[model samples]
Target: MNMRNLIVFSLLSLFMGLFLVLAFSLAGSGGVPQSMGVNNSFGEIKIKRMVAPDFSLDLYDDREIRLSELRGNVVVLDFWSSWCSPCRKEAAVLAEVYLEYRDKGVVFLGISIWDRDEDALAHIEEFDVQYPSGPDSKGEILVEYGVTGIPEKVFIDQRGNKVRKFTGPSTKDELVAILDDMLGSGY
Candidate 1:
């Protein structure tokens, strides 16, 4: 083979070897443990327990939601966009859960990311989302939360610590269980 062709072939082989090593390591490590595993039909969900970053999000309705101000309340921060189908699919689940826990001191805040204000507002109306939702306009809040994809939800405890992150469209049952656990823990 020519020198150029040989160089390309060697690079491809190196990348393939690295990929296989990562795959094996992840498989052998069993990856992060979760109360529920990934359901292929739905999507991948990752669980994380850590301190949540605080931000003051200005909703489209001229209201501001400060994460630090929400101390002593269980908060669910939903990151979504109008163009994402998974976000649309999880809309009802969020609305239903919001209704069920609204009176129970649980707070739900929707952060519309990577979309126009008009589109985000329209999506909220179309989904009939009653919770306080606003556009991430500049995407500052999105970056602060480390959101890599849409339909990711972060659950924060009452003490303003210990956030549980869900990286995909979560089901009603799963949301309920998490909220129940947070509420019952008296944190």
Candidate 2:
């Protein structure tokens, strides 16, 4: 083959070999680990891309959710508090967006910070929240995500990279558009 063709073929083979190695490494480990690779300049890639902080929390409904387990889909991590007025105001909007994107492989998770389970559940029921929500009983998730106040919205792309963080309240249109931009663009 010509020199140009030989170079292209060699690069393709090298990439395929890398892919095989990555796949086997993941399978042998049972699940994806945190902080896969770091370049120290361009940031790191974990679980095939940028790493989102992983955690397992018990939901109000007795179900459990681990952020790392929700790979291969867009993960929305919103830090909210039931006592925050802005959070109360955006409750309906959040529920609407959550229901709208429920079927499109988008996972919306609400982490109620600085709130008691009793109050959070009451607020959740008052808003008729359909998606499962849980209280950050230990505040570890809040510290990990660097949440400062209620109504903080974080968007994680399909590869687990935190793509956007919206502090304070957001309108329904604003959130829906973001979801569309991220999910529709196939990222």
Cα error of candidate 2 at position 174, Å:
0.4
- Per-residue lDDT of candidate 2, residues 1-187 (tens digit): 9999999999999999999888876674344321232111221122233477899989999999999888888888877777677777889999999999989989989888766678789999999888878988888998887665556778899888887777667788888888999988655
Q: Candidate 2 — which residues are off by over 4 angstroms?
A: 1-49
Least accurate stretch of 10 residues (summed lDDT) in model 1?
31-40
lDDT of predicted model 2 = 0.78
Error of 2 at 51 (Å): 1.3
The window of 10 residues in a row where model 2 has the poorest summed lDDT is 37-46
Total colliding residue pairs, candidate 1: 0
Assess each prediction's global lDDT (C-alpha) against the native: 0.80, 0.78
lDDT of 1 by residue, 1-187 (tens): 9999999999999999999877765673344212122222444355566678888889888989888998888999998877677788889889999999999989999998766677788889898999998877787887877777777788889878746777778899998888998899944
TM-scores for all candidates: the values are 0.73, 0.72
